[model samples]
Target: MRIEKEVSPEYEIPAVLQHIEARGRRPVLIFENVRNLNGTRSGLPVVINLFGARERLADALGTTVARLPLDYVAREKPLAPVVVDRAAAPVKQVVRTGADADLYELPVLTHHEMDLGPYLTSPSVWVRDLETGWTNCGILRVYVSGPRQMVVNFNIARHTFHYFQKYKAAKRDVPIVLVMGHHPAFYLGAQTKLLADEPHIIGGVMGEPLELAPSETWGSDIMVPAAADIVVEAEMSHSQLEIEGPFGEYTQYYGGQKLSPVAQVRAITRRKDAMYLDIMPGRADHLLLDAPMVEAYLYNRLKDVVPGVTAVHMPVSGTARLHAYIQMRKTNDGEPRTAIASALSSDYRLKHVVVVDEDVNIFDDAQVLWAIATRSQWDRDLLVLPGMMGTTLDPSADDILTAKGGIDATRPIDPHQFAMKLCIPEAVLSRVRLEDYLTPEGLRRL
Candidate 1:
């Protein structure tokens, strides 16, 4: 939807999206008349909530929502990138170097009411290892501090931080390229857990080779996606640190202010008519971007320890990072505990895991809750590990350590050993049609 009416980048865009979410709709919004941070109408349009719904992501991957995780896992193999000339790269159409590269020309958004200032919410930062030359890609938050400078928040556990450490140890600046506004597959591929060149993985997810173009700043040594709408070439300082954030995060809470690495913007390049993309932080758009990737990773990990694992879900209620629900066809009582341990160890951000039987619909909150209430006994089914390393973003964590807990909400394998669940006969359920039974008015009311 295109909004012809003028909208301020600060809070107004997010406020409109929040109201739409309350009404149970998430649509891609295009603000044609968005005011820049400098209070001038931006020539480029602003796109928000592009990946707000799971169905849209699935559609982008050419699959149904139910099959998204498995599909991602199956197609996540590495495929090399094909390089293209500058003339063929749309992002190189308009290049600005040094002082001419003004960030305020774009509509950078201030998402929440308390945000420090305008932020670039959808940057996929790319950096390469000095020794192995393996490139790492990560979607990181950037605070727009000035026209030529920005502060980047990098998680210590992530590869970007690891590469930054190597650069810092050598007292050398880290060469970085921030790619913005590409196909959803480009971002999805960057979420791979594998430690390899990410452009190849991006190609795999896109089902075609990712086209690369030599960077104007670093030339052939560093390449940017040829099809990206905007690409910012910058260098991360080795010794410089700046105060960044009190910014809204994926956990639906504000991350406290801390010193973070500063990036000096050297050049900016984009398509002639680039669209500024912003994800609604602490909302479905931010959380769901990583949900399917995490689910697929966990599902693959659980299969090694528990072969009967049927499905995995990271519910939105848990902010898609804190809680996980695993569905499995249990052969023995020990599998649930094993799955929990494997899952909890796989990611530091996960705090809780609930293992349920295959009969339970793990996607439905009510059914999963019912399984927990009916089948789990705290004394027998609960598993807790204290003082585990976890993300500090978790508000409940004590510094970098937090407790991890899990529940085995599965009944015995033998059906006759436990009380039978209430269910309608399959024959009757299959025959009954709600559309046939209900009147038009009744259906409309529903």
Candidate 2:
């Protein structure tokens, strides 16, 4: 079958609720009928942002997000995903038309009070493979226009933008499909390291190929998630334009929305009872978007450079790819530098990198800082590469140039002086909890 239909969005909502209840983070799976400023409820439902949590992120890849690449699978030869036709596709169960297609009718939340309007958040957008004709599905945010249209903000120097630009240069509309709703992985797959053709990588992740249907809206060339909640098929024109954003972005910063290009959405196909995925911007949704993408690149690079670079943590709290900590064995002095260099080069978006010995879990910021404080002698251990590629969104890069830096946070080894700290037993903690020191009743007594 082109699409499998077992799980429901409702099943995933509780997981998000628990995450928010515990962490005070943002990752809402809104299944309710969405309304616009006009307050009109629509029958069609859409899933906005799927990259909302590390767990959901893993759910996207069909594995635990914490699982390192070394734990399973070999990339020696990636397996191709299986594909089927629209007849077997659950996403195409129902289809919306041009007149009936009122985008504002769907309750696309204005996540933060400052948003460009309701945007299409959970789209594993499919485009033609640059090399072959295979379709490449990647999560990209497309802004909603009035009736039957969206404005895609493909961003400067992005691969998607480049692909569309190729078509734009030729005065052709880039045939595309924004898979409205699907597993978190569909979005995660799109955020993957841009290496070879990625549609096949989706096959590798699914352990099978996807079923696809020819986009009737586009002339025979476009195909999409057959089971998508919506397939917004439209073409572009040099004449069409609109002022778009003022939305909260992944950086947890407000980007004043501006005018962008326009495309007329001719057709939208979906499951009759499809779930709309909405990821409130400026929350975990934004951070998780780039984490695994950054992780995948680090995983591959570190493995080749460091002898046993088991894991790498680009802490979400660190703004996705900006700051990263790499876990590697203390093979020698060169390995840490190699890891740092690999990380800096792998992700142009990064600000700093801290490489540490295997004894230190890179995920622990305190431990990493501890290593930096004690073992590192600032001038000697640090490495800074100026004029390298990095994200302009970075406040540090506000100098308006591509600048980057990294730290070999690992201890310059003097094997004899090393000592591992001992930890108190958990049983002891159970015997004497924090309540003993600061009790609700005792506080008043004090």
- Give per-model TM-scores: 0.95, 0.81
Instruction: lDDT for model 2, please.
Output: 0.64
- Measured on C-alpha atoms, candidate 1 has an lDDT of 0.92
lDDT of residue 407 for candidate 1: 98
Worst lDDT run of 10 residues, candidate 2, spans 1-10
Instruction: Tell me the deviation in Å of residue 422 in model 2.
Output: 2.7
For each candidate in the order shown, give its overall lDDT on alpha carbons.
Answer: 0.92, 0.64
lDDT (Cα, 0-100) at 268 in candidate 1: 94
Local accuracy of candidate 1 as per-residue lDDT tens digits, 241-308: 99998999888889999899999999999999899999889999999999999999989889998999
- Please report the TM-score between candidate 1 and the true structure: 0.95
User: Model 2 over residues 1-446: C-alpha lDDT tens digits?
Assistant: 01122223322333444455476554444445444435655544434445555776555455675683332233212455445676787766776767765665555555555666667766676667444565556666678767677887767655666666666666766666677666544455555555546666655555556456666576446666665566666665434668778766767776756666787777777777877666655556667666765676678777877767878788867776688888877767888777788888886677788887777867668888887887677687888888787776666575436666667767556766665556788898679855678979887765
